[model samples]
Target: MDRRIDGLRVLACLMVVLLHVSSSHIHEFGPKWWSANVWDGLSRACVPLFFMLSGSTLLGRSESLTDFFRKRALRILPPLLLWSCFYLWWLWHNNAPTGNWLLAILRGPTMFHLWYFYAIAGLYLFMPVMRRFYQYSTQQEKIFFLVTWFLVASVYPTVQSLYTDVQCGRAGLLGDVYQLQYFGGYLGYLVLGAYLAERRIAWQKGAALFAVSSVGTILLTYWLSKRLGMPCEFFHLYLTPLVVLAAAGAFIAFLGQPAAPSSAGLQWLSGCTLGVYGLHPFVIDRLLISRGWMNSTGWVWIDPLIGTAAVFLVSLAVIGAIRLIKPLRWMV
Candidate 1:
């Protein structure tokens, strides 16, 4: 793995942790709520970055479909199932009615963040076909796919939102006549990741673009939220053009930077990112937020920062302890 990519993973994981930390307080009114909204908007790139990282590493790799499934299942499924069950137990322990454990697990559990695992698993299933498509596609064909994806997936939704009374509901020309369904969703991020990884931009250029898009995304989200008198839905959608630009710029910036010298500690933390991502929400939502640890300090500006660090460290320690058991190490 590229050490820079590893660094990107660590950064994405921390951003995700920060996002959840900030999100927990999003409904609160006043400065803290505004701060949470801004932080949440900034971290919107985290999941898209993960998707792009997947594209960078996974696409164009030559492997038999069976072998790919086996490897991905081993890498993804175990932790997903284990953590899903853990979250279900946590839900029950907190007096949240679980109803049926098996059904909950089948329906992706009550835990919100675990939805990523389910979505990514579906992506893994489709990757073999996507890989073959990439192998056969000419440069122009790839560009066409990306452009079509952006128009249909990113632009169409925003356009539709402009008219409040229109009820397109998957019956529109784009969906029905053009059948734009195939080019939508996180697949764009995946292919965009692979495409960007193969190209290079100057660090200065990348940084400037990233700063502009990131600031634009944050400000736009803030404005929308204020206008609607609630959290903005548009800016946070992963496929939103602003978000795409922000994520792509940040990704390019990271790609342009030279890999830093390997530190054993950093490498270890990077390696543990999957575990951290899988586990951190539990610490944030259940252990800290539920216990009011986040509110105990009453310092709006400082509490989230303190709480985020605490959640990250506690989650890391828990994952580290899980790794100590030989049989369970692979699951985490």
Candidate 2:
């Protein structure tokens, strides 16, 4: 039986929704417009949850490497290629690119942002060995990974900011590690997730830890963004720290309780989550966040809540519709 981790999945996907919805510049005529720093901090944990969950679920050694690669390839590449094509069509319709059609299709799509597909695909390809390492890796090795993650994705962001407006300079192991500090950022969180899987951490403690870390990170993020005038770009202290905090919190919250398929609501929510992921961008980008939605009275979060609701509704509809399809039925 699939140990359904849907609650966490739904939560993570919703966090992604929150991030997308909150970051938009849309505003409307409503009183529910205040943004929550808490939510901002909470949402940052979504991607890390995704990566960690994937590691926990898919890292099992029940399949051949060939089987593993094929399954992951089907799951990730199909959507990635399909979305890339969709984005290519979008760009062509907008006359945004007139260059080589194939090349442009490969390189020029908002679908490109779906790079998480690539990242996951890459991670999954190594599931066999990563899982093996989890079984054998020492605590010191784990520390090395987390330390590297901190130096690059977390610390480097602050260091780079001091130079201001400087473009990419020397690219090294450290720089690459610093660039994107999620999913262990260099195997830290991944290992943590695996370790928890191996040890069976308790849920309540994880939840409490999550709560604490999330609060701390958000406070730091706000101070940096509001007072220091620093943008919350990836690798920045505030954002990276927030992401790290969220990632840690997510692991604790998620792994504390083993996700069994016994729960009805969890299965239901998990079924709808993929729908949430695929369909949300359309409404958020097209309707709620279209333009001037951010011009609300003063409250910043009002639009995000409304937008999140709208996206969730669309996601539900999409999920329902997908459930009805014969060929595309697997998406939901």
Candidate 3:
């Protein structure tokens, strides 16, 4: 793999951390006009990029399913469990809903971040066979799969959500493999990343696709928002053409950079990204809320883009500080 891609991987992870920061305090960036819808709108791209990068990196790596599962589990599950404990602890301290004691143990992560870890782990267990099938797929056949994926994953759901006021999510029997297809909307990204990473698609062409699609998304999203009075946010849609465009553009744009030799500072921050992702919500939930950090400016009527960078830097510091703790240094 190219070092540039690894650098992009780092960027994408940072994007997720920053995304959580902004979400933790929606009052900050949520009101700005040009930038109001941007962060949350773009934040969805961050994790999708991670998935896509994961697909590309892991799919053709020639590891056995057992080996792949072992590696993937170690990489994600430990931190997930660690943070799950932290959130539940926080809830217990606050006397809030921690679920039934048994349910708390079963559900683990108290916030939404855990779902990312769960979904990724679920996908990891199944990727070996998917990879084999992917390898056997002709170019046309792959496109067909992608087309259906986009429709089921993004287009259909977006249309449905627009017409009806309801939330749509993964649905299937408890033990169903197809339950994973609920993540199908996300597969557009994962598959795109895998396709590009596998060298099945040319880099230049990918960049071009990204550029054209992203510009189109920005324009279309803006037009749709003005026309329909929609927020252009992603909540109502499973996947949007706009999100696919933005994420693809952002991923490629970041990937286009050359990697610098890792400085101790940069590498240290990189090492702390997982910790940052895990603990950021707790900070947002407990500290940010309790600390009274809400934007107090009367200028919000003008669409101020507040707290975008502030939340990220603050969260970065908090996560970095966690490494100094002797007992928990292993997780970060």
Candidate 4:
């Protein structure tokens, strides 16, 4: 295993927790919002980084469709179903308003964060073909594919913000008629990941790109949200140009680092990332914020960070405990 990938998993998992912890305060109009915005902005790359990680790790493999589905189902479907039910019960327990849990789930995730499961499931479904492409394509062709995806998937929507009157027909023509839609979506990140993993990047260059893109994302989000007189997620989107750059920079930056001494502790923490991701929201909503324990500090920076740390650690401990039980381990 690449220790760097393990390290990246832990970092991305923490970012996921921080994104949720700070998200509650982001809608407020004041200093709290600004602080939350900063935290949230920095964490927006979490999903993209995760997808890229999947790309790097999975896209290089050759497996039968049966084997692929079996492997992916073991990791994804059980937890998705179990967590969806758990959150449904949690929502009802809290008297949080919702409807038709069955339908809500069939349409998408019962909870917001679980949406990643759905997206990744879709990617997994397509991975067999994607893997073949990754295996057979020339370097130039791969670059061309990424360029096309970036232009259509990342650049096109970005342009829509500038040109409010941009026609869907024109986009349709470019997307459908040109067949560029095939190259769109999160698949590009997977391809990019596979490509980057094969090459070595200078840590200095990766760090510089990460720094600039991170700051740019924060500033752009703040200005846009303030301009709109409400919380805006334009720059927070994973597919947006700024966020794509930030995630790519982050992926390479961390992967470029010298390997740290092997630690079972780090490996254990990395293995628990998925479990922590599923359970942290429950910790946040029920255990922390609902009890008025989080965001209580007058210090903006301290509040979200503390809440994130608490949720992450609690969720990690819970997952670790669960993993010890033979029957329940598969759910996580």
Question: Which candidate tops TM-score?
Answer: 4
**Each prediction's Cα lDDT score?**
0.80, 0.61, 0.61, 0.85
In terms of TM-score, how similar is model 4 to the real structure?
0.93
Better of 1 and 3 by lDDT: 1
What local lDDT does model 2 show for residue 300? 58
Off by over 4 Å in 3: 21-35, 99-102, 165-183, 199-238, 257-265, 296-310, 321-330
Model 3 lDDT, full chain set: 0.61
RMSD in angstroms, candidate 4? Answer: 2.4
Task: Supply the TM-score for candidate 2.
Answer: 0.78
Q: What stretches of model 4 exceed 4 Å from their correct place? A: 96-102, 165-173, 259-262
Candidate 2: deviation at residue 176, Å? 9.0
Per-residue CA lDDT of model 4 for 1-332, tens digit only, reads 67889888899999999999888877767778888888988898888888999999998898899999999999999999989989998888879876888787788988889999999999999999999989999999999888888888888857775457443213354676777677677888999888887778977777677778878888988888789888876777788888888888888897788756548888888889999999988899877877998766779889898888889989999999999998998998
Off by over 4 Å in 1: 165-172, 259-262, 295-297
Q: Estimate the TM-score for candidate 1.
A: 0.92
Candidate 4 Cα deviation (angstroms), residue 84 = 0.6
Q: What local lDDT does model 3 show for residue 4?
A: 53
Each model's backbone clash number: 0, 16, 2, 0
What is the TM-score ranking, best to worst?
4, 1, 2, 3
